[model samples]
Target: MIRFIDLGDQILEGQSEFAWWDTISDSFEEFSGNQTWPNWKCFEEDYLLDEVREMIQDMRPLDRYKSLFPRDWSGTFVSAEDRKKRYEKGICDDIIDEDT
Candidate 1:
């Protein structure tokens, strides 16, 4: 089945190694059910937004998109904010799993 790494790769260029599988697998084990593949499409927009945010520092979102990735606007850029959100979400999810 499709996974986060693969989803990252397809949705965002050069993002295949964004996360660690061992952690994901271990987390999945605690879910107490089958681990279905992630929904890549749902994340594609966020990923693209983040990728654009990476190239240009201290710049507005629209400016970055227009200047850095105008031709290739797939919203693949992952921003620091997005990463932080993901990290927090993961931590929360992990905690819940641990408690269960």
Candidate 2:
């Protein structure tokens, strides 16, 4: 099971932001790349949050921080396909009124 402790009061909010690669590197600088940042299905086999925390403490980059979404490889909030569907559905009153 993936355990995500809240990015809580103790984490020092807004200290600074680092790139995605930086976070990954910081979290697993000691380990090989393949071992550090693994695919979701394989992540549980070798993931360690303590190392992640230690890396974040001294790292300086956030260009690639991804949210912990289930299928978010890039960690963006929504997939492109989802965005397109919402757009195609439209958001104006005209669309809603037609159905009503």
Candidate 3:
């Protein structure tokens, strides 16, 4: 039973910028009772707005951030055999160290 408010005129022409605040307020109320990790009701509107505005202002284009990493960065995967070998080696090393 999610209910949304009609921001009608508040979303028109010169009012659209501030309309986000009302939208956020409505969403906060809508989800406040749910078992969400971040309880939106715990935060004040002004503080949330300030933090959101700052985050938006500080955001860079995704491609720009992506370009900072290696283009050939695909070595994070491991085969089943490699994982099994590593696990066996770890167990063997632990047993040897314990014996010593």
Candidate 4:
């Protein structure tokens, strides 16, 4: 399961590392689940950074798509861009399997 921490950390259960962006440093950090080298920073040149960003980007659209209604339901409507905003505010929790 994918879990999001209050500090914008994305934790993938059973995975050795978790991804998080550091706003103050303007960089990404990867923390080991085993608490080994807790301050390990993942640089832009790291392949893992690119992979995690791509994975997050790919999953970004799913929330918006799932919000769409089929035919005549008149409920609150949220656009794709809105979904992005919600994610920015840390209001949306999207769970993904490790295989994904």
Candidate 5:
């Protein structure tokens, strides 16, 4: 069950940002030959606010500060191919992590 919380005033407006690996490590881009790898998936040109909102629906308490790259991120690092996985499974690691 992929549950997402609202990213509205009750969610995003007051919450901090989240992030992922791709943004922090230079190796992925430097070695992989993909110079522009993103640490966060929120900036994907293919995604819009509505799409992001629809994709992440039942989550709440967005101020967890789960991940970080260049500043905070609106969402986690998700590949285009893994989009469905996130939608279906949600963010397992971050949600389970006690540190964040």
Candidate 6:
């Protein structure tokens, strides 16, 4: 199947040796009724925008794609606005998986 994944890599300091996840990170979506580590944030096919998926279909990622990935996180965004507006600041280190 053509997977529509919300690709991401995370770094949890002092967590594990392989904490610095790289390409093909865990999907944001689920499969087989559960989230997979090999892929964490995968976007369900039915939910993905047709145009965005189609555009991706026409091309393949080698290093990185600009349109496909609007932003590549360079540093920690710990500002109050960033925490509030962009990404919510977590209370603990443990990941809290929310069902959307």
Q: Give the winner by lDDT.
A: 4
lDDT for 54 (candidate 5): 45
Assess each prediction's global lDDT (C-alpha) against the native.
Answer: 0.36, 0.32, 0.32, 0.37, 0.31, 0.33
lDDT (Cα, 0-100) at 25 in candidate 2: 33
Model 2 bad stretches (over 4 Å): 1-32, 35-40, 48-82, 90-100
Candidate 2 yields a Cα-based lDDT of 0.32
Error of 5 at 18 (Å): 17
Model 1: ten consecutive residues of lowest lDDT: 28-37
lDDT of 6 by residue, 1-100 (tens): 1232432333333221111123464434332343322221332332243344555445543223223432443333243333344444565344433431
What would the per-residue lDDT of candidate 3 be over residues 11-89, giving only the tens digit for each residue? Answer: 3332211111223345433112321112112222333344344553355322332344334433234334545666687
How far off is residue 88 in model 3, in Å? Answer: 15
Sort all candidates by TM-score, best to worst.
2, 3, 4, 6, 1, 5
Instruction: After superposing candidate 5 on the true structure, give the runs of residues whose Cα lies further than 4 Å from its correct spot.
Output: 1-70, 73-77, 92-100
> In candidate 4, how many Å is residue 87 off?
0.4
lDDT-superior candidate, 1 or 4:
4
In candidate 2, what are the lDDT values of residues 13-83, reduced to their tens digit? Answer: 32211111224334422222342332333333223334464464345222122244234243223334445
Off by over 4 Å in 1: 1-37, 56-100
- Candidate 1 lDDT over 1-100, as tens digits, reads 1112333455344443222123423542111122222333433344345544454235333343233322433435554455566778784332223332
Give all TM-scores, in the order shown: 0.18, 0.23, 0.21, 0.20, 0.17, 0.19
Whole-model lDDT, model 5: 0.31
Q: Cα RMSD for candidate 2?
A: 13.7
Worst 10 residues of 3 by lDDT: 30-39
